[model samples]
Target: MLALAALPLGVRVTVLEPDEHAPARLCARHLHAPYTDPAALNELAACDAVTLEFENVPVEALAALQDRVPVRPGGALLARSKHRAHEKRALQGAGATTAPFEAIEADTDLPGALARVGGRGILKTSELGYDGKGQARVNSDAELRAAWENLGRVPCVLEGLVSFEREVSLAVARTPAGQVAFGPLVENVHRDGILRSSVFPAQVPDGTEARARELARAVADAWALEGLITLEFFQLPGGDLIVNEVAPRVHNSGHLTQDGGGVSQFEAQVRAVLNLPLSDWRPLHPTAMVNVVGVDGPDGSPLTPDWAAIDALDGTRVHLYHKAHRHGRKVGHVNLVAPDPGTLRARLASLEPLIP
Candidate 1:
């Protein structure tokens, strides 16, 4: 998607991905090599600017290219985000309210950590955890110990679960000069810790939405960010919003902008990284996005989606990643737009069975 967005701007992209069959290979210049390969890093250094789409990028790799090209969002932010403990601390440091949590780095810390977080919480790896991976739920000492052992006993953060009405996310784009663009707050639904769908405009109070943007911008400003940063929030019944996690790049929740008939998040990333003028972040329609996760059904049967059937539905557009579908893999997404919320909800319900 980034490659498609950059093409009109005449910005060529060279992708360094270890997966030879990566869908990006179809559009961008494919450098089929490991991310840290010295040769690949040198090749990337020749580009006008470098931006990361995922958080697990090796910070040292970005450091290697710093002297030769611009790395948007910078290596500093990446380092902080790579570790969950550091991320939570940074959020609180910026005066954002996040879930109550404690960091655990050893066996003895488990008991105290559990007690600190109300004796029950999620144990997540401090690093390399996403899409419901590298974490476990625990309610007692035995469960915590077993989960920790199951997780390989790595550096982890125990987050105390809190009650909230719904989940929402806000995307913020920042330039090197400190200018910012904020995307509308979008309500999100997650199944098994992976994003299932998202709806635009959030159905949130104007002030609550404004507060979300304020928190996102504050973190971006504090981090001296350059590029897109998305902050996920849990909206409480009392209308308070607490930070859940932060992604220092364009996020899955903001994918609706791709078909929203305005400046998409991909373009925003390009503009922010290149120090170009940003565009308006408003969308033309009320949009909802449902991820096309793998092609498997609940009974473990292959159920590849019929494009014709999908096309038969109104207000729907398909975006395929052109990758092999494995269980729980996000191969692509479908965007649905409606004249109003009532129609959108009905469309989503009808389209649910079509997704696998």
Candidate 2:
């Protein structure tokens, strides 16, 4: 849905999606087909350039499109970000700090790997995991075996848990011509591994924000990145930051940019991919973006909340995805802007009951 912001920039969008009812299709022309279908590839090749909404796209499909049309951030970056092991290495190669991790290809290796991470760690699948899915927190040998079995005994990475003060993210945009822009650092709150809310102008020690900006710029330069890139970080108690994960597309944490920052992340991506000049992004106000997760009905459809209550709130803008709600799905979000962080938090609290 955020991608719709690019439309006003005078760019026509053609979304190639398998799901006819995907939210973004509501605002743009959509070609319904699987991403890996040859016919779909042919259709995508007609576009001037292509960018992805998410990073888990099939590498084979991207590789096929690369020869036919430009795919921003390219297949190499996509492949690297899709797998946990590869992403860790990429961050290290970029000279970014990351948690200690080891690969576990078999259930038997779980015990030894756990010991290496100090007997407690997060075991994540090497591929296809998001929002706390395909992950397990194991502290014992029995839990380790269960985690391995739960993940289908696939290749996995065991990461030592770090004692961090907070979780924050930086959204950076770069153009083919090497121009770069960054959205404000955002402090994220998560529940069950799914992002619950993003608070802009994150409350951190002095110099933390500058460090994050520097890190983000370095990562963007290292990847020769084009379009939007978000880097998640863990702020240690001592005020140091470590790379947590990288998302090579518009990020949920950046949704606040729509109202707080002078330009939205989506528009920045459009500018980057089109090789247009980026705006001087600045925060217009303190903002809070809260995700509206869905609840399953008895028939397994999404049960929506009272829109009137949400719309009645002052300084709040509600965006609902045109999708049938399924349990735990991100059906929409509410972006609230205020004069300061305290006002933003209060506004968020008032609207909490309206979100499923």
Candidate 3:
């Protein structure tokens, strides 16, 4: 829905979705977030233009779309993101700092992996993994063996976990003509490895923010990418930032931009793909975005949010994704903006009752 909302008014968008229905846009429905979808051939035939919402579409699907209309970022970048090892390798080649890691394949030696990353590391699947799924944290030999068994012994990557102070991210977009624009740095909070909240102007030092933005811009240039790209970073205790990962699509951390930033991530992504000039990247207000997960809501029924109360606050905004309710499902989000981070935090807390 966000991807659709960002489209230029004059540009006609034919959404290539596996869902044969209108209400259910499969483009934004993948759990693992694969950039390619095998059903692309059929979806592309239904329209004159084509675009994608998620990065997890199957490569074969994008190939089909390429035969019809031009696909931004192309299949190569999408394929690179599916495999954790490849994504890390690409970032390294771009001269970006990342955590030490090793690839785990069917015949790959476990002792060789141990030598590269040490005993404690996180095992992530090669393809189709997100929000803590298809991943496991292994600190011992028994855990590693169990994780491999639990994951069906599929190919994976082992990334050594670091003792970082906090998680931060930057969202940037690049035009087909090579122009680029960036959104404000956002601080992310995760619960059980799932994103719970995000705040703009991430309470980091000015120098740190500058470095984050620089890294993001460099990534966009590295890909020669012409769409939204989100780069996750880890702020170390010593005030240095290291790139964690990249997502070649609209990111959860940038959801606050809809009402807080001068140019929303959605709009930026749209303009880039449409070959339009980039908009000014300014902050409308200091904002904090809270994710509303369906964990503690009513069962077997839609949870109706208290909109009247939410609409009363100044600069308070809400966005509800039209998705069916399920455990841990992201149904909607609330963005609260104020003069400072503290005030924004307080305002966000006041809207909790209105969330469900």
Candidate 4:
């Protein structure tokens, strides 16, 4: 998607992926090779500059590429964000608030760690966890032990449960020259640990928006980010915002910017990476973005979408990923833009039946 946006700006994008059927292949020129493949890395290194769409790209691969081509957000940011303990320490070092957390290594006393986190907490793998995977919520010692064992008893972080009022995300872009741009704070709702919807210009408390923007800028600056970064935050009932997680690339929560913000997150990313000027992050209209999850059919395959119903909606744009789907997998998204929030909400409600 970002590649498509970059094309009009005279930026050519070449994607490198191991899966030939990867959805991004539909939109950009693709190299069908493993990310760690030396041949593929050489091809990528030949590019003017390189930026990653997903954060899970191996640090070793990136380090090899960095010697030849510039990797935005850099290896240090990737190394820190990929590990829960490092992420927490980075956020704390930046003076950003985060949930109470304790690291659990192999030799750590599991019961004592659980007790320290109030006995009811989420134990997450230190690395490679997303979309609700690699985490276990436990309320008892037995469950904690089971969770730890289930995770192969690897390194983990135990986070105390938080009573947050709502979840929101802020997407910010920065260039190597210190230029910065911030997208609107988006209020998001998650179902089964997957994001269901993201509404822009979140209806936050009076000072919350300002605070989120400040914190996002601080994070971007802290990392000396050269591309886009997203910060997921938990807004507590008392109007305090705590950093939940960080994604060092274009984020799902900022998908609405594709339609509502003249300069979509993709374009902003391209601009930042190419050293082009960025536009102000202002929405042209109120928008609601709903993720289209895959539904299982009788034979256990993903059911075909209701294209007839989806095509009939006005002011709604549908983006479908050209990939096979599984239950709860993000196949695509629908963007509904309107003159105001009320109308956007109504449109979103009417389109609910077509979501899955």
The regions of model 4 sitting more than 4 angstroms off are 298-301
How close is each model in CA RMSD to the real structure?
1.3, 1.8, 3.8, 1.4
Q: Give the TM-score of candidate 4.
A: 0.96
lDDT value for candidate 3?
0.75
Across 1-356, the per-residue lDDT of candidate 4 in tens digits comes to 98889889988889999898977777788999988999989998999889978888899989998778878878889898889999988998888999888898775467587778776899999999899999999888788888989999899998989999999998888887888888888999998888999997688889998899899888888878888888999999978999999998989988888888588888888888887888557578998898988889888877766778877987789887776777878889988888888888888888877866
TM-score of every model versus the real structure:
0.97, 0.95, 0.87, 0.96
Candidate 4, after superposition: displacement of residue 288 in Å?
A: 0.8
1-356, model 3: which lDDT tens digit per residue?
A: 55455444455445544444433354333222223554545555455334456777677877766656656766777888767889889888877899999887864446556547866889888888888889999987677767877888898888888889999998888877888888878899898778988887688865988888788878778877777778999999866988888888878988888887577777777777777889646468898887878765445655666788888987787887766677777888888889887888788678766765
Which candidate should be chosen as best, given lDDT against the real structure?
1
Candidate 1 yields a Cα-based lDDT of 0.88
Which scores better on TM-score, 2 or 3?
Answer: 2
Which 10-residue window of candidate 2 scores lowest in summed lDDT? Answer: 106-115
Q: Rank the candidates by lDDT, best first.
A: 1, 4, 2, 3
Residues 20-49 of candidate 2 have per-residue lDDT tens digits of 776667778878888898987888899888
lDDT of each: 0.88, 0.85, 0.75, 0.86
| Model 1 bad stretches (over 4 Å) | 295-301
Reference-based lDDT, residue 171, model 2: 82
Badly placed stretches (over 4 Å) of model 2 are: 280-282, 297-303
**Model 3 clashes, total count:** 12
